[model samples]
Structures are given as C-alpha cells and as structure tokens.
Target: MTTLYLLGSAAPPVLDIASVIERAQARGYDVCLGLTPSAARWLEPGAAGLERLTGHPVRSGYKAPGARDVWPPADVVLFAPATFNSVNSWALGLTSSFVVGFAAEAIGKGIPLVAMPCVNSAYARHRAFGRSVAELREMGVTVLYGPGGFEPNLPGERRPGGFPWELALDAVDALAP
Candidate 1:
C-alpha cells in the first residue's frame, strides 16, 4: 500500500480532516494523520474516532526518548489547510512542531510533498506569503495555491467547507509514479 502522511494545521478546514482520510483510504492509501499542536487540540473531540479510522494514533508530538517509531516513513505527504504560520515556518526551516519538522526534512529526503494553504485574502497579500510559496516550490515541494488550487478566502468568513482538498489529492496523484 502507498503510505501517505496527511498533515493538518489549525484552520477551519481542520474539522473536515476525516474526509481527507476517508478519501485517501478509498484511493488505496495507507494514511496516517498528523496535526499541528493547535490542530490536535481542536481535534480532541474526535481524536479517538480518527485513530479508529486510521488504525493509528493521531500523532502531534515526537515519541519518547529512544522509543520505537510506530508510524512508517511516509511515501508522500499532503499538508491540508496549511496555516499562514505553518507555511512560513516550513519555508524558513522551523521544526517547532512535528508537522513542520516533517515538511522540512521531507525536502531533503526527496519525499514528494503537497501543501494547501488556507488563509484569508488579507493574509495572502503579505509579501512573505508569496515568497514562502515560491521558496517551497523551488524546493520541489508542490505548494498548491493560486488559480486552480486554494484561493484566499474573504476576511471574517467562516467558510469551513470551501477548502479544495481534491486539489491536494490530485497533486499527490500527479506526483506519483
């Protein structure tokens, strides 16, 4: 089976991560879910359900010292509803969380990566945002954004279901050999 790590950030779309997991499974992906620290807290209500769905713990932090790694190394990684903070942090090589850490290392490991950033139009206009997207793309990470990917949402909008998750999955399919 193709092992995929689905990394989620703290955003409105995080609530719908189960669908991503379900979709990947339908596509024959052995999916493991990883959440940013804040995302994990938001997902607390359904944490057990998520674990049951994937048959693995929804990991947010590193394992105990010298402890065995439970999850397998990812064949590909998809970061959905990636926050503005996580995008910039990943570009700047910040491993403050397990999700970002995996992103940083994945680049060097040559593991295929796809990212979908969820930000409002105001935040998307920031100079660093474009630069970070460019930087990630230059690293060969498919940072899904712009016209066909994730478009910036209007400010103050609670548009939870608007995230284009299929684009992320399509990126994965396109990248796969």
Candidate 2:
C-alpha cells in the first residue's frame, strides 16, 4: 500500500482529522499521522483513538537519534491545516518542529509533498506568507492556497465550511506511486 505521511498543524480542521484519515484510507493509502506540538496537544484526548485508526504512533517530537523509525517510509506527504508558523518555518528552512523539520528534509529526499494552509485573512496578508507559499512551490511542493485551495477568512472569523482535505488528498494521489 502507498504510505501517506499525513501531517497537520494547529488549526481547527485538525480537530476532526480522524475523518480525514479515514478518507485517505478509503482512497487506498496507509496513512501515518504527524502533528505540530500544539496540534498534538489539541488532539491529546483523542490520541489513542487516532493511533488506533492509523495503526502507527502519532509523532509530534523527534525520536531519539539512531532510533529505528516506527512508521514506514513515505510514498507521499500531505500537510493540511498548515498554520502560518509552519508555512513560514518550512519555507525559511527552520526545522524546530518535527513536522516542519521532516518536511524540509523531504524536499531534499525527492519526496512528493503537498501543503494547504489554514490561516486567517490577517495572517495571509502578511508579506511573509505569500513569499513562503512561493518558496514552497519553488521547492516542488504542491501548495493549496488562494483560489483553488484554502482561502483565508477574517481574523476571529470561523469559516462555515470544513477544510479542504480532499484537495490535499487529490494532490497526494497524483503524486503517490
């Protein structure tokens, strides 16, 4: 089965990521879930259920150096609900967080990567965000943003619709072997 490294960041969509996982599984992927630290915290109460769902450890932090990897090597990586911090950090090559760190390295390893940001309009307006999105694209990452992907809402405004996990998954499907 194709292994999808489905990564998430601290965003509301992440709250309901289990359904997304199920969707990916239905599409014939062996999904492995990774989260930003805050995202891991937000989903802590349901961590066990998520682990059971994926049949892999939900990793937010790095394993010990030289530790055997628990999850299988990725055939594709899809990062949805990527927060502003994660987007900027990844584009800037800052790998403080394991999710961003792994994504950064994935680029060099020739992994097919897709990302979708879930940020408010305020954050999207930042100069850094646009630049970061461009940078990721330059790195060969299929970033779902703007018209065809995630549209930012006003600050403090919750969009009525769910995050577009399907779009990310579709992009992954295109890239996955």
Candidate 3:
C-alpha cells in the first residue's frame, strides 16, 4: 500500500481534505493527515471528519508518551495548500509542529516530497518564496504550482483539470519504481 502523508497549511484554498482523501482512496492509496496549528483553524470541525473519511487518525502536534507511534514511514509526502509560513519553516528545517516535523523527518529519510504551494500571488511571487522553492527543488522535492493567476475558494473551483490530484498520484507513482 502507498502510505500518503497529507500535510495541510493555513492558506485560503485549504485544498478540501475530503476531496483529496476521496481521490487518494479512488487511486488505492492509504492516507494519513498532519496539520499545522494554523491549518487546523482553517480545517474547522476538527480533523475528525477526515479521519472518518480516510479511516486513519489525523495527527497534529508531537507524539505523546506511548502514543503507539501510528505513523508508518510514508511512501510519499504531499503538502497541499502549502502556506508561505510552512514553506519558510520547512526550508529552514524548523520542526515546531507535527506537520513540519513529519516533513523534516521525511526529507532526512530520503522520502519523496511534493509540495503544492497555495499562497496568494504576492507571497507566491516574493523573492524569498522563490528561493525556498529553489532550495526545496535542489533537495529533490517536487514543488507543484497551481494555476498561475486565479484564486479559487471552493474545492471544485481550485481543482480544475485535476492537476492537484494528478501531481500527488504522479509523485507516488514515480516513487513506486
């Protein structure tokens, strides 16, 4: 089974975890979600809905004492709706939260990482963001960019042509070899 680590951020699109979970399930992959604190705020109703949808717990924060260590080494890590904050943090090796920690660990273990940045045009075009994207690419992470212009709020609005799902599954498929 392909173990997918879904990392979320506080960006506006949010990537609609439910849609991502559905697509991943349809593609025959098991998924676990990890959320940043700010991302949690945007996720709303808690990640319980996601857990129910994917049949796996949504992990946030550090693992507790004897918490059973549920995270298996992931086959592929996809950070959808990756925020500017998360991009910056991950680039700097900051593991202050569960999402960032998992990303850091995955990178160290040579796991394939794909990030779909979801910042606004201003942030996306910023020099620092460009540098961070370059650094991540140099480290062999696949950085996926959404449509260059429009900012869509809803899942359907944002998912035109299914590039997000394609990028995610493509990353997993590439790692399969």
Best by TM-score: 2
What TM-score does structure 2 among the candidates reach?
0.98
lDDT of 2 by residue, 64-101 (tens): 99999999999999988899999999999999999999
Q: Please list the C-alpha lDDT of all candidates, in the order they appear.
A: 0.91, 0.94, 0.74
Pairs with steric clashes in candidate 1: none
Model 2 lDDT at residue 89: 98
lDDT of 1 by residue, 1-177 (tens): 888999999998989999889998998898899999999999999999999999989999978889988888799999988999999999999899999998899899999999999999999999999999999999999988998889897898865667888889989878754
lDDT of 2 at 98: 92
lDDT of 1: 0.91
Error of 3 at 43 (Å): 2.2
Show the colliding residue pairs in model 3: none
As for lDDT, the candidate ahead, 1 or 3, is: 1
For each candidate in turn, the TM-score is: 0.96, 0.98, 0.83
